[model samples]
Target: MQSSSSYPEAVEQLIAGFRRLPGVGARTAERLALAVLRWTPEELHDFGLLLATLPERVGECRVCGNLAEDDLCPVCRDPARDQSIICVVENADQVPVIERSGGHRGLYHVLGGRIVPLDGIGPEDLRIGELRARLDSGEVRELVLATGSDIEGEATATYLARELRRPGLAITRIATGIPVGADLAFADSATLATALNSRRPVG
Candidate 1:
């Protein structure tokens, strides 16, 4: 196809890079690239360095699979956190959302992603074995399913609840304060707190 872009090739390349970011549409990406052009060379260099070194600076938490600067995340390393309660979430992003709510002081378990068969995602695709290993230690007394309210999230929670159910293990699901089909990552702090506080037994 013939090129329709009026801007220089460098500007188009920068815009294309911005478009790769989530929620950055064509116009928004172009705007962002133009905004970057307004920045000082030093500032742009710093920004590029930050992005380039991000992988080396941050890694997945060895314990909960959340983003971390070290092998263990801050939460996992905290002695004051209640290790007896493990609030299960779909991804690392949801961890900060729940933390910001200030309702949960328990440990976390990141499932990586929810079970969506239509997308070729299943229980086997998740970190279910690692979660089971956590439970095997007998330190966790409760398993709170704090996954999203969406179909795939609900299905993942149901499957987990059944698989992890055992005597003395209190399995529960967060309340429906979040709207249906909404992700926990997008929930407000207050709403997330209410949902966490009102969580009920799942099985």
Candidate 2:
């Protein structure tokens, strides 16, 4: 008995698409497909339009490499944000994680990714040049490394510390609380706050 034969090809395709999303398993994908099937045609149409327009509407911020609708992200555009400090994160999503903690009041620089040697990703592959340019402007006084505690994150932080050491600039890494091998995206608000509050200088 072929279990998938009961559903139409389109329904199976929808389930497959849902499965492609991060952390979504086959059972959850099937449930999501069923839920979508139950939605009104208008709602489904609106969702389709949202998905279709996403790529065109969303663009990377030229300054910090974060997601934005225009040239600069909201953080970069905000006048009240502390321009003297910059929090460096591995991904755009981690920005919100730190923001919700309410421990940081500065600007952000998304690295796009960490340095992974085995995967052939290096510092040059990231947005390091852009970050350096921002620092060279003499406006930034401090940098907080909020990358994950994984090996790649560690290597990226170490490389950045060495390359970004300047006379007036202070470099620090988020202290322990976020366990080793864990991504900042998964850390809770309180834990993230503690890490930020206890950040120590990077050697």
Per-residue alpha-carbon lDDT of model 1 for 89-168, expressed as tens digits? 88898899899999899999999988889889889989999999999999899999988787877888899999999988
Instruction: List, residue by residue over 96-152, the lDDT tens digit for candidate 2.
Output: 888999999999999988898899998899999999999989999999998878777
Distance from true position, residue 109, model 2, in Å? 0.5
For candidate 2, the 10 contiguous residues with the lowest summed lDDT are: 176-185
- Name every residue pair that clashes in candidate 2: none
Taking all chains together, each candidate's TM-score versus the true structure is 0.88, 0.92
Task: Tell how far residue 113 is off in model 1, in angstroms.
Answer: 1.2
Q: CA shift at 150, candidate 2, in angstroms?
A: 2.5
Question: How high is the CA lDDT of each candidate model?
Answer: 0.89, 0.89
Model 1 segments more than 4 A misplaced = 1-4, 180-182
Instruction: Please give the TM-score that candidate 1 achieves against the real structure.
Output: 0.88
